[model samples]
Target: MKEIVQINLDNEMDLILAHKRCMKIAEMCGMASSLQTRFATAVSEVARCAIAKGKDSLLVLNINIIKATQKEITAIITDNVDLKSCSPDAFIYASKISHHIEYQYSNNQSLTKISLPIPSPGLLSETKIKTLIDYFKFETPLSPYDEIRKKNIELIALSEKLAESENKYKQLANTIPILICVINERNNVLLVNESLENYLDKPLLSFDRKTLMNFIHTEDIDGILEGWNKAKQNRSNFLGETRIKKDSNYIWHLISIVPNKTEDGSFNSWLVYFVDINAQKMMVETLKDNTQLKLIQHELENANSKLRFKNKELEQFAYIASHDLQEPLRKIMIMLSRAGEHLSEDQKKKYYFDRITSAAGRLSNLITDVLNYSRIENKEQYFEKVDLNKIIIDVLGDLSLVIEEKHAVINVNPLPTVFGLDTQLRQLLYNLINNALKFNAKQPSVKVLHENVPKDEHLPIGAENYEVIAISDNGIGMDSKYSNRIFDMFQRLHERDQYGGNGIGLALCRRIIENHNGIINFTSKPDEGTTFWIYFPKNKLYTAKLSLKNQSSN
Candidate 1:
C-alpha cells in the first residue's frame, strides 16, 4: 500500500513551503536516514520542475508499494501545466535517469544493490512514503508511459549534442586538474570524470553513488541541499560555491548541478562540475585587508572637490574631461539668438531659441553639475553653528537686486539655529530660493518658511539633540514624481535657460545635510510648492550644522 498526494503552489516561496512540508513527513515516518534523504531529493526535483515551467500549476502524483521481504515505495507524479513551446520529450528523458543504491545490511554480511527510480517533481516524498508505510498492501507496478521511450532517444541525442559542443571543457579540466563529478538527487555518485580523481584523492569506490555526500564539506551540506531542493521543485539547474574538507581544512569549489530527465519526466541524474578558485579567494582576502585601497574610492569625492577649486590648472583638466562641451553649447545659443535677431519683423527666433538654447544650456549645465558635484567634498571645509534665519536673509539680500529687477514677491519667516557649515547652508537656501523663482513664468512669487521639529523628527537617535529644518517654498511647484531624484546632481526637470543654475544645488544640499549626520528629503506635487526637510543631530564627532553660518552672520 502507498499514499498519494498532490499540490499546486505558484510562488517561489510557496514551492519552498511545499518542499518543507514534504521533508517533515519523512522525519515523522521514522524512515531510515538514507531513505529519508532519498525521499527529500525526489520531492525537490519535481517541485523545481513545477516552478521553472511557468504558470502556477498543480502536480498530480500516484504512489504505490513494491513488496518482497521488505517494502519499497514507488511514486509517479504528473503536471497538467501548459508550457511554452519546448520538446516535452526532452523534459521526460531527463527525468528517466535511474539511481543505484548499495544498501547496508544489519547482519555481518555484504550489502545489496538496489535500483530505485526517483519520483517526478511536485509530490513531497515524506507525504506519500509515510502514507504507504501507514497502510501496507501489495500492488502491481505503477508503470510509466511506454511511449515516452521513443522521445527519450531524441532527448538523449539533443542532450549529447549540447554536451559535445563543450569539446574543450574536458581538456581544460584536465589541464587545471580540477575535480568534477556528477551525482544523483540522492547524492549518489553516478559518474566521476577522470579529472575528478585529483580532488577526491581516493579510490573510485569511496566516491561512488552510495558515499558521494560524505566528501562534501560539513558547512556546505545545507547549501547543497537547499539548491537541490529548489531545483527539484522548480525544475532548474543549481549552481553555487561550497568547500570540500581536505586534511582538516576546506578547499573552496564552485559546484553546479544540472538535471537530466526522461521523456516521461523522470529525473535521471545530476551533471555537476567544479573549479578551484584559490587564487581569486586569496586576492579577495588581500583587498579586504588593504585599508587605504578600500577608502580611496570613497575619498574620490574629496579628490574631485580639490580638482574643482577654481584653479587655472584644473580649467584645462576640466576642459580635457568635458572636452570642449561648453563651446558647442555657447555656439548654439549664439546661432539661435543671432538667427532670431536676423528674422523678419513678423518672425521671432526667441520662441525657437527657447527650445534650442534650453536644450544646449541644459546639456552644458549637466556636464558642469556632474564635475562640480564630484568635487564638493574634495577641498577642506570647516563647520560651526549656523543661524538658519540669517542664511535665508543673506541669500534674500544677495538676490535683492534680482528680486527688485524681476518684481518678485518674497515672503520669509524666522528660522532656528543649526550646527552646519555656513557656506553650505547659504548655498542650500540660495538653491531653494533660486529653483522656486526660476520655474515660475508668472507672478514670480516665493515664500520661505521654517519649522523646528527636533525630537519629533525621523532621525537615527544616536545623539543628544536632533533638529529638523524644513525649507518649504510657495512657487510653481515641481512634480512629485521627481521628488526622489530632485536631490540628484545633474537631474533637472526644466530647461537650463528656463531655470538658470546647475542642478547640483539640491544634491549638494543633501550631501551637506548628510555630512552633518542629518537626513534630507522632500515632498512635492505638480503645481504645488516643494518642501525640503533637512535633519541635524548634535554629536561630538559629527557637528556639521551651524558654525559657518554663525560666524558669517555674526
Candidate 2:
C-alpha cells in the first residue's frame, strides 16, 4: 500500500479537502468520473460523521492491489473515538457506495476503510505511484472558495464555447452522426437524433434523463447528475467526461449540456451531446503520465518566485519597524522626559519641546517616504515615450530654490526619448539631481548627458543597443564598496543629522529604474564627484510595454 494524502477531519473545510483529494486520486488511478465521485462522496460522508461523533479523526488515502487484474483505491478513516459507540449511518452509506467497506473497533479507537475498485490497475504502476506521491507532497491545497471559483470559471468557458455555434446546433445534430438529445427543464426527454437512438438501441422519446443514467456506467451516474443539478441552478452549460454503456461494454464519452434560453435569458431546455472521446482519453492518459513531473516543477518554480518576492517585502517592512522607525520615536520620548527637569527654566523647557517637535516631524516624514516607496509596486502607472530633457527641466524647476541657494551650475545635454513611466521618470531625475545639490563640500556643478552604445554584457538580455544617460555631480562622494548597499531601503552611509532627508530616496530611485526595466549604477570615490549611469534597452519598446502590463496585472 502507498499513501497518497492524509487529512485530519476537523471541520467542514477538511471534509471538502478529503473529498477533493479522494476524487483526484481516483482520477489519477484511471477511474472514470462516475467512480471518482462515488469514491469521493463516500469518503466525505464518513469524514462528516467522524467530525461530528469522533475525536482526532484522520482520513488516509492509499492504493493496494486486490488481485491479478484488479486494484483498489482505499480511504482509511480512523478516529480515536469509537464509532461503535456512535452511529453506523456513515459506514452503512459507504458500504452501499464503495466496492467494499471494513470497520474495526480496537481499544478506544474505531477504524473504517472504504475501497473503490480500479478497472485499469496498470495506470497505478510503481513509477506512476511514486510520481503521485511526490506530486502530492509538494502540491499546495486550494481553499473551498478557490475550488468553487475555479469551477465557475470552467463553466463559463464551456458556456461560451457552446454559445459560439448555438444557432446551428439543431442542424448539426440532425446531419452529423454524433449522438445528440434534447431534454426539457424537468429532465424529461423532448427530442433525440437518429444517431442517439441507434447508439442506445432504443427509439426516440422512449428515454428520459433517468433512463439515460441507466445507460451510463454506475461510477459516472452521480457526477453527471451533479453536473445537471448545478447547470439547472445556474442556467448555464455543463461539460464532463464519463463512461457510457453500449450493449454490454462501456466507452468513454465527453458529455456536454448546452442550456436553451428564452429571449428573456431564462433557461427552458438543454441540448446534450455524447461525444465518443475514448481514443482522445487514451492519448491524454499517456501525455499526462509523461508531463506530470514537468508540470509540477514549473508550478514549484512559479510558487517559489512569488514567495521570495513577498518575503523580501516583509523583510523591508520589518527592518523599518525595528530600526528606522525606532530612532525618531526614541528621541521624541527622551526629549519629553528631559523636558520635565527644566520646568523652572523657560528657555531650557522650550528648547526640549522644540527638539521633540522636530523629532516628531522627522518621524512623520520617514513614514511618508516609506509609504511612497511601498506604493511604487502598487501604483497604477502607465508607460509612454518619455522625454528625458523635459523630465530634467521639470525636476530642475522644482529644485530652483535649492539650486539658487547652492549657487549650482547645471549643464544638460540633449537626451533621447525613452519608453517609460513619465511620473516615475520625473521622480528619478529629481532624486539624482537633488542629491547632487545636497551632497556637496563647496560649489555644486552637475552635468546630464546621454549616449547610445552597441549591445554588450552591461545591457539587458537580447537587446540590440543601449541608451545610456549619465548624471555626474561635483559632490562629496562615498566609498565604492557602499554602492550596492546604498540602494537598499533605509540604508545610509552618513549620520541622520548630517543628511537632511531620509535614506529611502536612493531605494525609491532604484525601484523606479527597475520598474522601467532599466539599470542604474554608479562610480564614486571619497571626496571625488560620483557619476550615475542609467541604461535602458534601445529596442525595448514592445518588450517594455508588455513587461510593464504584465507587472501591473500581477
The sequence of per-residue lDDT tens digits that candidate 1 reaches over residues 1-554 is 44445556465554554444444444444543334444444444444555666444553333333433344433333345433122344234324432532323233322222224333323435565556444323322211222222222333343343245334434433543446566666656766777676556464443233354556776677777788778878868988887776667777777877777542345777667775554445445556656656455544545455434524333334334443445544554565555555444333331233554566566667667655544445222466678887788789888887788778888777766776677767777787777767666666766565554455333334324555555655566777666656776556677644656656778877776666667666667766676666666644356454332223545
Judged by lDDT against the true structure, how good is candidate 2? Answer: 0.72
Model 1 gets an lDDT of 0.54
Q: What TM-score, over all chains together, does every model reach?
A: 0.36, 0.38
**Residue pairs whose backbone atoms clash in candidate 2:** 34-219, 34-220, 35-219
Model 1 ranges with Cα > 4 A deviation: 1-320, 327-358, 378-381, 384-390, 405-408, 413-420, 440-451, 454-464, 476-482, 490-504, 525-528, 543-554
**Candidate 1, 485: how far from true, in Å?**
3.2
Cα lDDT computed for each candidate against the true fold:
0.54, 0.72
For model 1 the TM-score comes to 0.36
Most TM-score-accurate candidate:
2
Give Cα distance to truth, residue 433, candidate 2, Å.
0.5
